[model samples]
Target: MKYIFFVLCWWLAGTLSAQQLKGRVLEAGKDGNVGLPGANVYWLGIPGGVATDVDGNFAIEKRPNGRLIISFVGYASDTLEIGEKDHYIEVVLKAGHQLDEAKVFKRGQTTIMNTKSPVIEQVITGEELCKAACCNLGESFTTNASVDVSYADAVTGAKQIQLLGLNGKYVQMMTENMPNFRGVSVLYGLNYVPGPWMSAISVSKGVGSVTNGYEAIAGQISVDYKKPQGSEKFYVNLYGSDEEMFEFNMNGSIHLNDKWSTALLVHGDWMEKEHSMHHNGFLDMPKKAQYNLMNRWAYKTDAWFVQFGGKFLDENRLGGQKGFREEMRHQIGEGNLYGISINTRRYEGFLKVGYLMPQYENTSMALLVNYTDHDQESYYGGYEYDARQRSLFMNYIYQSIFGNNPNQKFSAGASFNYDNYDEIFGDYKRTENGLVKNTPVNPQREERVGGVFFQYTGTFWTKLTLMAGLRYDYHNLAGGFVTPRFHIAYMPDEMTTLKFSGGKGRRYAAVLAENAYLLASGRSVNVAGQLLSGRPGALKNLDMEEAWNFGVLLNRKFLLFDRLLNINLDYYRTDFSHQVVADNETRPGMINFYNLDGDSYSNCYQVEIRYELIPRFDIMGAYRYNDARITYSAPEGLRRVRTPLQSRYKGLINLSYYTNMKKWQFDFTTQFNGPGRLPGGNQQFESFQLMNAQVTKFFRKWSIYAGCENIGDFTQKHPIIAADAPWSVDFDASRIWGPIHGRKFYVGLRFGFDRD
Candidate 1:
């Protein structure tokens, strides 16, 4: 049998190489030793534990009569005693509380949750993205409550996100772990990052971790930039807004000695003012300019690690009506107004490598590479969309530990993906009773995939945890597939926890580069079969979407009166089997794309809470619900409804405060939103409330801030559906829902210089 399966894989790699235990977990800052990325390293009666990466490193597996615990979350916990040749270590912790004679620090927790992860992660940080005016990553989830950002039409302002309730292209995004934005950059790619270049973001709800592939299904965000060796040798931010919008950012870092390092980042933003608020002559937002750049490099040693990076971007947009202009977009008849244009260019490069073997014991190996190029050109009034994309990705991993149980672990991988697309869509003019015709459609394609994966994880007695994974892929055009995943977590004490997960995901549906916001609406675009053919691997008759996600989570903590309270609950479900339906409601102008006939689904539910209510004051709350359905094709035929502009429940509340030598800070937020349907599903839309606030002041390195957004200005009075015809067919700017810009205000300034 293949030489007894190669001698049982060489006797399980010689019984997993025997013993191990490596470390790192620092914190003693003032710019000197930071690295505590998700702390928590255990061993006091071991049962598998680890969590540290992003420079805080870790590796575990040697236990023979314990004593090691190290913790985090506001710090102060540590212990060790391991000798017998202690295989590498470094611990450090220490910050805050020590009463009876001084020492009081406290200030951490701007969103974090990771009671030993088995997925169901959270982590937002960088102090919750500075409260507001995050200026990118599409406004960084204002006070986040499990993702949900909007604005997908009402004149080319494109922004979208939603998780568990779907969309955001089934959520996979990623940056530090590679695969980003994907195909034509998913409509503006969430404004192309740049929220001070993030220092954390990590979401992760369900179904993630087949070594990051198979497109997350409805979860997984991961960003975490800001580190070329822990950032800040200089930094700056300046912003302004009141609808005139403006921004600038800068970053810096450089080390070059203890094993190299480098970083550079820059960004610019502009908005050229023009707001039609509810007067609706369109243009409620758009008229933007952007430029971004990045550079990164790193190299570490003591068992090698290297990173490399490159990025560049350019963007411009201009929206319609309000006296359209962008050089009249190829005028041909009488004042050619009604304009909207978008132009974008992007390029990226990446590489990562890691190694650790040194003759093995807790072996390791890693490699990742990425490349992307995206281009877009758009017009929305006479309808024209253009796209281009080229992508490449690769992955390779190998980690070990099994027979000599480091609580059993394994990872094996191989992956490759490549995509090439060029698209163009129609109607340059086309008026019927008035003659003017030109129609186009050019689609091109290329896709390749190759995969292999295997994952396994286990832990037991010290409070469960188990995971399993599998993968197999081959797709020159939808020909092979197999993926499976599972997870489980349990804690049941130490203040509760529980989790469950399930997965399966698949992708390949760039349908006009993800709907290009339905071509800003005077619709007319349909495809029911031959799935866009300009030849070249014509997608073998479409169908490569597939889904399956399942989830459950629960976390708890409570200690009230003396502070400390946290609660969470989660539920998720997604089911599809195949999907690629766009269908703008049976027919209304038009927009159809097909490949699924029966049911589709989504179900989400959430509940959250956090409290600190006394010391530095904090509070949070959340609620969500969605039922999302699908099955369309109706003039009375296949029906199943709901899922049209989404919404059906959401709520939030937030508050924050600080004062006490930390120097003033305050924040507030509110939301309610609920009611939805809109899209020929018999009307339903109304229910609102939104508010925001912020303030800050600090010094030493500098800080100043201010903010406000939608403060009850609620707006949605007419989100474009035909406001006095613009080449009318009932001009439909994609039926948005709520907030078409209203209460504004913003201000900012920050400066830094931390690295020392």
Candidate 2:
């Protein structure tokens, strides 16, 4: 039978797997610990081999039964003979740490490992991404706790991220640290970035450089695409979900002779199912399609670095009553009717150049320019919303030292930004007795913004660092604003660091994007005044949402049971001067929007730890707590609302087992989320708990992973919102919390290659 043939093939592949001739790679040091990462470890004259990671851990397969070569840059090469009995051995490299993960730094732009910033920074390297199969870079957060991903309104099939307990818009998204997220891209941009092409993702929480322009209320997430000069090959991936969605990811890198290299990354998604099968008379999902493309090139030499890249994205979605058809674009329910369609296109490009100064050991000057064009068109039950956005961004980062000490580094930078926005919320009417009538209400808006910033950092006392930054914004709509940030770090010992940050930040909030679910019911926005000036039929009254944030954090590392253990904790708080609140209790057909009349704020606390228990075994855990609220003018003059619903306590555990006895490995991981508050529409949804787990197996040249989400199938027993007037204007989709979907299982496989 075919099943037996398949089993035979699998067994043959596993049986042929190269026998283990393991070895330990170590750094020649005083304590006999610390592995040399990036060491060129391989079998002598073998056809293939690999280097060690920073932890000096590596597994090389397909090597013949013989001797091997150990070589690294700036270090003497050594040869070691191996016999069949020599399953494992230990190698100690000479103290020339150059071969031991020595980072490269030449000027303005550098990797986090080489950065001299006083703030804490972490990098998610490409190699780590390859450890699993994922569709987009946004999905890469599976193992990272600093960033949280959430479902974008259930029907839209979109996902947004959270950082420091704040929304994605507040965290600031960038391509290589250059501004890009805005307009339509703000809706589904997470899907636009394919996972295969990213080289690394850098996360800088707390206050960053003023040069980045102060958009980050909690942190900054910079996406770094793979550079063209040094890239590995062509990749193609196919991913599918139980919900009947398919995703395609591909990236190709080519060398045009010696001086030129180019790369193109693309992501495509499609779904055939229109109904969610729950058949609540509401579309469980929508017919949707999306495409994204990015082309990048980089050139580098000993003295100069130049990189240029461009990106484009297009997407469409249609949703409504279960039986609704796109051709009719209309429907009527026993109680009411609704239909929705959305289309968007976005384009962006950037260029950066860096010139290293030969006079200074670590000095460089850089110039950068970023430009974007974004637009969107959509219809929510025949009420159309059209929008366009254009922006230009520029920044410079220069670094040098006042003294001969290379560690005594100083950094400074400036930035410029511009934005032009135009939006129109189409007219609307109502049908009370199954009769249609037109009520003319056209709302439009236009606005512009300009900003400038300066930032610097320095180190003193060999154990202290300070970073202070400032920024000013000149608006064509809301007048002016200022942002100031400061950070301090004190290291009592090499293993522990106490870091604190204080910053004042302000953002002109775009309410709809921050909470699009509120309008999922086709509720028109009712404004008191103008949001932006100089437009016909524009909302005459609106104001910017402003706030200030401060944070303190500490991290410690130790050697437990002869292995590494890491712990990190942070606390952050924000105070709002002006916040936009949606008052739905007043009118069901529309919502009230106004600046805060009282107090509004949020608090966040988090902790994480990771430890290696023994060879091939490790464990990790994370927890987060968020407290947020908003105050606004009500019929009662002022009222406060707790943040919609969210989990207050979250935890995760992971374990892995591998050994030299067999050519196999197993990995298991579990995540747990605790209950929190929920909102009430006609009625409130109850808080709930969630637990999920996955298991993976590695064999020969292939890897396999399978998992079940919502393992307990926990969900609110009651509908999220009550008073579902299918015939009236009283409907709300924003009152959602906890997992709405039940338990589901998934599986995946992966194989890769690289050529030299």
Using TM-score as the measure, the top candidate is: 2
lDDT of 1 by residue, 79-194 (tens): 79887678878988876522222322345466777756677788787878888879888788889988988988888888888887888988889888888887678767989998
Which residue pairs collide, candidate 2?
335-726, 335-727, 336-726, 529-540, 529-541, 530-539, 530-540, 530-541, 530-542
As a TM-score, model 2 comes out at: 0.80
Could you tell me the lDDT of residue 160 within candidate 2? 75
For residues 287-376, write the lDDT of model 2, one tens digit per residue.
888888989887766677788989888888887666565665444444445666778888989999989998777888898899988887
Q: Locate the minimum summed-lDDT window of 10 residues in model 2.
A: 105-114
How does model 2 fare in lDDT? 0.63
